[model samples]
Target: MSKQLPDLTPIGVVAIAALCTTSLLVGVRSLGALQRWELLVFDWMIRLRPDDPPDPRLLVVGITEDDLSRFGWPLSDRTLAQALNQLQQHDPAAIGLDLYRNLSQPPGYEELVAELNAPNLIGIENDNVDPPPTLPEARIGFNDLVSDPDGPIRRNLMTFEIEGKTRYSFSLRLALHYLQLKGLAPEVSPTGAIVWGKAVFEPLTSTSGGYATIDAKGYQILLNYRAEDRAVETVTLSQVLDRQVPPEWIEDKIIAIGTIAPSIGDVHYTPYSSTSSHPFMAGVVIHAQMLSQLLSAVIDGRPLFWFWSEGVEIAWILAWTVGGAAIAWWCRHPLLLVAVSAGGIGVLVLTTWGIFLAAGWIPFVTPVLGWAIAGSGVVAYRAYQSGRQQQIVMKLLGQSTSPEVADALWSSRDHLLKNGKLPGQKLVATMLFTDLKDFSTISEQMPPEALLEWLNEYLEMLTEVVQEHHGIINKFTGDGIMAAFGVPIARQQPEEIAEDAYNAVSCGLTMSDRLQILNREWQQRGLPVIQMRVGIYTGPIVAGSLGGKERLEYGMIGDSVNIASRLESCEKDRQSSICRVLIARETLTLIREQFVVEHWGPLALKGKHQMVDVYRVLARQQKTGEVPVEPPVDFPQPKR
Candidate 1:
């Protein structure tokens, strides 16, 4: 038989599972929990990178508790002027006073105002604080950092509209001033992003990276934080005022001054806070880090964090979903599947980590979850299909077939079965039909219960004989049985077909002997004894499952099957013994060499148009220790 069509069930299952899982993850991501997980993973990826050395061009002067004790809260204007004067003398590229100097703390206000007029000094302001009244707007930048809802600073606000005018951030102002000193001024790219040399600073959107619903009102970008230990070079405000700081540390570097004392309450959480002993970084250090980031990207060619478009990200997640399902489909063993699935998840995580290291921010948690759910769906579907197939096979073939045959049928199910049912196939094999002689008369002689018991005992013996000879009892018609050899699995070789015919003839002979013993036992027990008629034929027949799903059975249909049944009841006066076996010329042709058979002549079988030569299989051909010549006779050819 030709091979059946390839099964599309697995592919279908994978597609639906992957699609559904992808959709679910996408929906869940929109609900925010998945987005938060992805952000956490992003932080971990950042933390996992090799430590970046402290940038030599950035310095932070933080006022500590000692400074507060020495100069009191809100340092006097004279003290502030002294610090600025010391920093200016070092010839720094730009000085960013992270402290809001809008309010006056006077004792020497004139001195503070005069020092703030330096061309490179940038004053800080916030929504609640104004820039120094004496300082020009060109000399001011807002010292505000954007924090996520969960309280970690991860983005830098570059510029925002205030009273229909653009105001720059503290970090941006310092970075731009430092770059301008090196003759590398910022310019707007064709796409409207900030461009300096080959670096393009793209602003972040509400959906950038792992952020799903961020308030992206101002121009912002992902803050790529450096290692905590070497984030920036720092010195105390008292040290700056005492002129103890090295001039080289300030020369041509962007200097940021702010408070770092715990009592000052200027500390904020950062991505490294979770793993660091100090879970917060001073606000001054964050501004220095942001400024350093911009300078490095523009001058040193360091990369900025990037992200894939929404469409590309979705496709990437779907790819992993399909991959997970494919892995499950290839691995049939549960242990192997589990092992491979774990490995698949490991590979996915590593891949995303590697990409993150390259400054490409893509989703990790969503794809991992999607992969797991899709693989599980496929596994569950396979389990269901396996149980369903087992039930259908048992229902159609029954339990009479031998274990080896049943296994073989199951193994070749991909080729033998279609849509949970056996497809019809044409094969050249033997069919055996058996009937209890005078079954009607025997039934009348006993009550229903006793008759059922007697019939079951005889049928059980017949089923065992058929199974032993590798034949399947296709179905039962009242007291008669229709059994087939070389069924479910087609015989590919002519020799195999001939073997099936030999087994069918041998099975009939065994039945004759088995019936004799059964009759003797019944006679001894004072129960009614009965005879049997068995007819065997070898020819082409179409075999497959019959009836709908609710009621099903394996059945054979062909002229050969009808002939087998007709031979069993052809002539009642022809019984020569208690159990009789008659085979057509076709079956006799294959087993004639091994059996002694009597030629009963050609006769027209009921419902058959042509005459069929019948033979009586008496017993095994007696061997005389010598080869015997076979007689030749003309045989009728079967119509195709």
Candidate 2:
């Protein structure tokens, strides 16, 4: 058995490709780049979100710069009281005084406390301070905003239990207060989730998008900011205090109060705000966003932001890993594979965002990186693989074939090394046997070194012709050569086997013609001319590696090979010709019209039980063209 081309590249390529793909997927969920990309894709989705007109039921009343300039920095308690008294007359549903009045900023302290005691005035309190601010417990809520690590608010803390007291957020309390007047009070479900009217807010945990471990300390949920336009109907504190505000703007409206002064207002970042020249929204407006989302979820049936189950996300990552590996394996060319991978990434992003725009939270980063890792990694492995295979082929063929031919074989190794390794297989091939005529007589007349040099010249010429015809020279015996075709690489179709047959006969005839020209050159150089007889037999044969583990040679072993060798001896045909080429009838059937053949009839060969029909190949039929190579200047063309 001959040495097989070991499977080096394919298995390693698959393993490394899989490893790289998996690493990319894991990195996407764990690495910071993936998190940033997820955020960017999210921002794009937010930017593309359709805008809605401001809700008519809710109103935003803020202390604008004009109001601040009029009311003097921190408005005195009397000014706050005067604004409150004016709002009371309008019969608004609820009033959220977003400013913290834990310490009195007073010109009229007694009057401000009296106005603060009103049932609709919701005061803000801060828990971050050492001595937490005090408020009328019934009308107070914590004014705390939960920001992501990027310092932008995307989640809402509806209600948190602190020191056994269930404290609500500034927005949730304000919204509840407004809903209560309309006979829709906030209720807690048996599951401990807040249900505003009919909408149950699903809370966000640490596992929410890209949040591996977050502080989920409260009744937190994703905050979907109001659409692009100014969603809140607004009026300033000065307008309300000066009695310049229309009654209808405050009447029956859920009014939220905050300062819009860029200098003094509590500002925070939000999604919709990113599109503005000044992206920071007032703390009160952020709270208003929370309230609007809640009310809209209940009344308008708006969908809440949601994340995929952990199992589903893992499966998605795994799916992309496999997809990347498959694409890498199928496309081995580096540049072409990269282009394909780029196209794949583009499609993934477009499809992911398309689903996101439709309210589906599909991931984009993990999958695409998996594709690049698999694709580029596979391309690298195959390039290494090609170099290794080329080395092996060069090592095996030795100095018999040219570097160009070896490179050509390396480039097309996928055809030769099927499924990574070549296994022993039965195939149909042509075996050509060539022996120098009168070699014993010629060799005895020359010195040992001269005869050896003489043999090499003939061998080189024959080997080159065999390679040109895509045949493998197996071995040299004394002064004869044995070559086989369609070995190691099996032919899948019958037409391929016939082509192998054609190549064998063409190579034998070319060697004969080249030898006659070589004879003229030898005659001029005062060297003895030589003649060689060729025999070709085509049939079903077993062609593969042959020998022990240390020494190996690929060759064919069958009756066809034996028959071709026997015919090349010239003694079996009972002919006296100097050098003639004979082909078996089995081979003749495949190339009957392509050569000028003489029927030599059935003749029993050495070591064969029965007689087999043979034909002498006189000459090859020229192709249908006028130009012949060299124009036969010295030798006349042989006639049919």
Best candidate (score: lDDT): 1
Worst 10 residues of 1 by lDDT: 631-640
> Model 1: per-residue lDDT, tens digit, 155-262?
999899979999999888888788878889888878879888658989898877788888988789899887776788889988998888988999988888999998
Q: lDDT of all the models against the reference?
A: 0.85, 0.73
Q: What is candidate 2's lDDT per residue for 1-640, written digit by digit as tens?
A: 5455345455566666766677656665754556656665676677787776787777787888888777797888788878888888998888888876766676887887877777887877777532113346777888889987667787898888879988888887777777777687767789877677667777777766656556888789888777654767777887787788899988887778888778895888776565778788888778888888878877777777777877787677667766676677777666877777778777787878777665566666676777667666666666666766565454445445444445655666677654333335687888889987667788888999988987888888888888888887777777878887765466789787888888888888788778877777777977778767888888878865455335445557788889988888745434434347789889888886887788889988889999989888766766788454442223332221
RMSD of each: 6.5, 5.3
Q: Model 2, clash count? A: 4
- Local error of candidate 2 at residue 66 (angstroms): 3.6
lDDT of 2 at 625: 81
Residue ranges of candidate 1 with Cα displaced over 4 Å: 1-13, 64-79, 104-111, 238-244, 326-347, 383-388, 493-526, 547-553, 570-640
